[model samples]
Target: MAASMSVTFLDVGQGDATLVSADGHHVLIDGGQARDDAIVPLRRKGIQQLDLVVATHAHADHIGGLISVLEDKPVDTLWYNGDEHTTQTFEAFLDAALDSAARYVEPTRGRTKALGGLEVTALHPGGDTQGGHLHDRNIVVRVSQGACSAVITGDIETDGEHDILRSSIEVDADVLELGHHGSRTSTGQRWLEAVDPDYVVAQYSEGNHYGHPHGEVLERVERAGAEMLGTGAHGTIRMRCSGGEWQARTEAQGPVVAGDREAEAAPGAPAEEPPATEAEVGCIDLNEASPEALEQIVHIGSVRAEAIIDGRPWSSVSELDVIHGLGPARVGDIEEQGEACVR
Candidate 1:
């Protein structure tokens, strides 16, 4: 059987779309901004049904591909943070939600649902505050299966971050979908401290204007010791949850067996030693493995181990801070090292 539940993050240049399957259920977080382009990737990844469709906000990059996603697969439950602005893309999302006969869910601070055995909970969308407020309000969804969990934060910014921090919500997550494509204004240090995810995933188009994942944001993400995964680089990120051992699959990676990590240790095994499985390098599941399991990589040490265990499923590998020990290391070195073994 597959090792675990799966989260497939499509590389749709500058757009956001993640296909997730866990415990025999499928849930799509969002489609790329280009609905047509997004559907092709969905088909490529073998996505057929969308048990839940979440439009984090009314941004084009977040929901432009909704029509295409629904066209390919029926969306069972549609959720979006109600917007105060009336952008064309927002209207399109509402239309698709209505036409598809989906149950529109305005997620609150603590609503939960069961997708197979996986648990999905809402953590953001405290609603637009009274008086003047920055409009980055978003519907952040947290999906968990056993010990693994990932928090998907839609185009939220620092102001929105404040609201989420103030709420009586569980901000602690294994992985955090970096807000606003890793904008400097979104990942506040305090907020980062609260989540301290093992991975930080970013959704952005290649060569797009407004240079997403700004340098400062990138530095902050790295400083936090979380890893970064990108649609720009990782191709498509897919994960599987097998009880507590979350196995990940991606267009850029291969396969792995648990025992392969241990018993084969050559003590001083060269950091450049070959991987036991065809699994992608630098990528690890937070739900599985141990401190020693973490040290298998070249530069990884005790501190990095703490970060991995401290944070569960990471949004991406870039935020994992491998550079802390390895330094601008090549992808092959840490690519499949089990970023966060979250189940």
Candidate 2:
């Protein structure tokens, strides 16, 4: 029987943290900001030691909490990008890494390492990537266990994604940690096509200053036909794979088994088919549709439905951009879905 692999996307609030466990070995990736207490999840999971700890980049949001993790946990190896930063957080992380007993290795493109039952590979930041924007030089890692794999990108923008794509390393995976927290600057159309992940996770805080998980990114992910999960919305999300199959569970939506995403039929919609899951369902009149009907649209949820209702008498689908979080691209998705109409 093949062993099960579990990947937990921690809700670190406006930052990123993920833990991968397989065959009783654990790997920690890119602890969130210093105040996020990213180690708490580790403690909750009863993990006393980590087989490998990775610093995906020098950004504080990605490496700050790692200082504490390195100091407190017993780690066998540390993999980090060689990029240098002057922030106190980066210096503190360096001091902690040096102080720890773990061996340090500077990761390069196409370097693969073994940690228990998982094959961890570096897929970004080649030799030529030196001395560019930090986001462009971010280190990207892919973790594979059997036929199931996941790519965790740490704030890599389009340039970094292009670098990885240009390298042509096999990046197809079951899950993808959306780059740059789902910023429009990352997760380009070409990148999404290459990955073709079943699930794409965006790790950030709700109402964050940068408005992460941008609407354009959301539209693209929808267009790509991949389910999108967000830490800001679902809290901590855990994905498990066994026998070459994957399932996900989230704190907000318990027991989200594979191929069983929530589907609802709007009022007056046909009962035999759900508009949310069907390809050709009747569109709800946005001006006259109830909250429940409005919720059937691609991005409109309960809150957004209420907002749409309160801001009544829409002129066109493009007018949805006036509502918060409903950017032009996302509104376009709703229009493209043909689920919400102004009439």
Candidate 3:
């Protein structure tokens, strides 16, 4: 088995940014809304150069941060879905890629590449994007190392999902980044069943006007018997694959065996001790603490931390309940240990 492959689903507030690293080679899937949204995490992870940078599609939320990355980091190659967009962000991204002097390749379906020990396969937009919805033309990529695999579905919708299913391609993966931020129009029952993922990560903003990761989509993910984690709730979900096994850990949730549908903690795993009370840790101003910092509060795991980050500038601790999974009990626990500092 290779040493380890790490996948980080960055919390980029209403957008998607994922980093995959194996054997010192790195690949960035998408960039969030702001430069720091992707840069800060990259710096924290000590990633100075990217083996490949993939702007799954030409959306601002997905390509905006890549402009900064291209300016700051030395990316060897760039990949896109071949969909054209007239937006300023997409244009700027293209200019940056050109300026960065990286090899630019618009991948097609069935194209595969080996990045160190990881195998990356392009699974979508097999052909032209002329007549289809933009979202349906997303560049879906499957990454695998040893026995663990993860599929990164950009903003693909139901039509794209069905197209992928009909193609002679494999959709099964241990971790599936839910399509279109878990919108009802995507992740259909048949699609989820076909993927049969063990874990699903949905990246969306809390209180998003769009109401992403809709209740219905959540229900479908549950019905698929897959453990779901939302970047809206969990700050950054990290999955590490090693020795033919994988484990997922969030800044708040510590570590859990990845792909375990039973949600069982690995043997000899530390007990699920409650976090430090707000009083002990001092009041965390919901608007000020970084997503990584918010994870320290009692009962505030990655998901809740992300929710708190999303619902920023809280007027009172009472407002915490608005975040999914925070509930009344969890809110009470947080209030006792910390104060919601709102200006």
The digit string of per-residue lDDT tens for model 1 on 1-343 reads 2224566677777877876665446677778788775677545334456688887766778788887776567878888766654777767667767778678888777888897667788877665443343245577778887777787876778877788788857777666777887677688888888987766777776555777777788778778866566655445555544445544443443432333432122111222333333234324554455554454333455577666768666665555554345444533345443343333
Clashes of 2: 1
Off by over 4 Å in 2: 263-343
Using TM-score, rank the candidates from best to worst: 2, 3, 1
lDDT of 2 at 79: 92
Q: Which ten residues in a row have the lowest lDDT in candidate 1?
A: 262-271
Using all chains and alpha carbons, the TM-scores for the candidates as numbered come to: 0.69, 0.75, 0.75
Every model's Cα RMSD, please?
A: 13.8, 17.0, 13.2
Question: Of the candidates shown, which would achieve the greatest lDDT relative to the real structure?
Answer: 2
Q: Compared with the true structure, what per-residue lDDT tens digits does model 2 show for residues 177-215? A: 999988999999999999998888899888788878888
Off by over 4 Å in 1: 1-3, 127-135, 243-343
Clash pairs detected, candidate 3: 233-303, 234-302, 234-303, 278-337, 278-338, 279-337
Per lDDT, what order, best first? 2, 3, 1
Candidate 1, overall lDDT? 0.64
TM-score of predicted model 2? 0.75
In model 3, which regions exceed 4 Å deviation?
Answer: 128-132, 258-343
lDDT of 3 at 100: 97
